[model samples]
Target: MNLNQLKISVRLVGAFIVVAMVGAALGLFAIFNMRTLNDADTDLYERETVGLALVKEANVQRYAAVVGLRDAVLATSAESRAAAIKRIEAGRAKSLELMAQARQKADDAESQAAYAKVDEAWKADQNALDEVLKLLAASEPMQDSPVLQHLRDVVAPPSIKVGMMMTELTQSQERRAQQVSDANTALYENSRNVMLALIVVGVVVGVGLGVVISRSVTRPLAVAVDSAERISKGDLMQPLQAQGKDETAVLLRALESMRGQLVEVVGRIRQGSQSVSLASAEIAQGNQ
Candidate 1:
């Protein structure tokens, strides 16, 4: 159906509804993307950032354990050796706890595999440390003893392997964190572009609807005004076309009816004047 056939109020309301729908779409799109970005940020913090911190802390503790073990082997007095052993035990315990926590955060298969390798290397290193501790407890060897050579050959290599593995694990966590950060950056860019496009589309649609509604009302009113002007100047022969069911069409119909009534009244007045003139002429002739 033609939009002009609708009431002026209905036409205006329809235009508003169209614009409102576009606005609603933009709002919903923004909400959904914002929710997505929030989720990404939470995951980055919880998984990537926290996990990397855990891995780094574990590596530090592992290094401390290796250092304490070396100090125990090189200690000159019993009390110093005991103190070094205490440090070794404390560092091992803390490192194990942190490694467990880091392992729990490994979500992907590759990360889990890397943690597994680190765990295996750490176990080997712990076993080697325990062997050296046992030797030291039994003999309390001197600094240049065969036990020192044994420590260098057996215990130190395993500790070095563990450090290397820890380094690898730390690198893995850093890479994963970087990947997550990059993905978030890309998602933000994509969301920004999409929102801008939606805004542009909404503006265009709103403007187009406003123009259409305005013209539909204004064009019909212009025609009505012209018809009224002609009627005021006593030029009533021109007919008005009242083609729609709107208020403008009703006004035009009313004006056409008034014009028809005026034409009928004028015709009656002209015939009456002609009849009076004829009667006056006949009376004069008779009198002559």
Candidate 2:
């Protein structure tokens, strides 16, 4: 049926339900986008950022081992040599542990491959260090020695290679994280725009509905009020135009019935007065 045929209560409830539905839909939309953003953030931090940090730590451990080896070669006394050897072993152990952690944290195939290179290079560097240490323990010469030449040619170059590989891995992960951040930022903007558009549409629909329902209710009430005013001024002949099955229609119909009954009662009273007057005249004439 038309809006005017519906009761005011039904019209109001229907409007409210429409607005609630729109609100719920927008809320769910926002929640889904937010969940996506949260997942992206987690992946960026846990998979990429943390992995970068661990690889850097591994490189630092490799540098420490290099320093220990240099000091062991230059040790002047037996006690100093023993202490340097102990420090060198400790640095090697720490380097291995840090590299393992870095490998475990690597996320993608590229990053895993880079870690593998670092691992292979580190193993060769360790083997070279072991050779140098053996010569140091035998009290080999400090300058122009095969151990010094090996350190300069083999161990030093591979140590640099490992550092370079780790640096490249760190840069790659940073770029990936930046890409994720940019994507998430774009998604956020799109979601905000959609939400704003939905809000505007909802407001427009609500206002339009309110105006229609108000006119539907108030127009009939205005007609009923005018009818009642005329009837109060003793003009009860015309019937009320009750258009709908709503409350206002019911009230108007009742008013129309009451006006008809009042008009009939007034006509009966006038007739009775006329009959009494005629009877009085007859009685007076008879008396005369």
Candidate 3:
């Protein structure tokens, strides 16, 4: 209740607030960091996995173009025709190599499924190309013949199937990536709102408790001052009761003891006045 006690109480409250704030900050920081990592994973997967899917589709397209061209080639004695054939073959080999690389680096289920489809499509297309290659090796033109006709018939339906499959795969990858991004954003928002609510609650509770503590400390001082005033009026029959073992109790005890001594002095003065009156009466009778 004294100044020193008030200071101690304030310091204790301050220390508690500092510790609580630090802990809250650390907890919020951890939450924020965890959310960031989650978001990053989603972003990274969207980039790497979807990119692989698109790459696989591109390779499939390249394969289809080469097979279609092979079905169109007619062997001729022209130098330009042979050169074109060789160039198309080289491109087909490069496309296959890229498809293999894409399959190796595929990271997600959707991408892996796309890679599988591309491989199956490539093998089916090769069945037709192999026959066409045989015809080309024979140095014959087959563009208007049954060999190209059979392949065009076989490759058409599958080309349609592969196209639909690739489109579906690409679409599915996009949807999953979008879902991840949306979920990550929602989680971040929820966590931020929760942390903000906690800070607000902590501030309100801390301020309310600090006020209560201040009142508790000052109430003792007010009681001590009132008791001192009562003793000053010579009304010392009852002193204030000491409340606790703290400094407030010590102050009340000292004041109570002083009040008792003052009461005794007042009694002694009253008694001495009575004696002086009686002795003066006796001396007046003797003089008469």
Taking every candidate in turn, the Cα RMSD to the unseen true structure, in Å, is 8.1, 8.9, 8.6
* Candidate 3 lDDT (Cα, 0 to 1): 0.70
Superior candidate under lDDT, 1 versus 2:
1
Clashing pairs counted in every model: 0, 0, 0
Candidate ranking (lDDT, best to worst):
1, 2, 3
Report the poorest 10 consecutive residues by lDDT, candidate 2: 140-149
What clash pairs does model 2 have?
none
Question: Candidate 3 regions off by >4 Å?
Answer: 1-6, 74-147, 225-288
Summarize candidate 1's per-residue lDDT along 151-215 as a digit string, tens digits: 65678678767766776777687668767777776777677777767777776777677667767
Question: Top TM-score: which candidate number?
Answer: 3
**Best-first order by TM-score:** 3, 1, 2
Tens-digit lDDT track for model 3 on 1-288? 354665646765675577668767876787779778876777566567656665766566666556445444743334534664665576577667666655665567987887788778878877877777676666655344576455456755687587668768877876887787778778877877887788768766776676677666666777777877887776778766777788877887788888888889989999999999999999999999
In terms of lDDT, which candidate is strongest?
1
Worst 10 residues of 3 by lDDT: 71-80
TM for candidate 1 is: 0.55
Instruction: Evaluate candidate 3 by giving its C-alpha RMSD to the native, one decimal.
Output: 8.6
lDDT of 1 at 113: 91
Task: Give candidate 2's whole-model lDDT.
Answer: 0.75
Flag clash pairs in model 3.
none
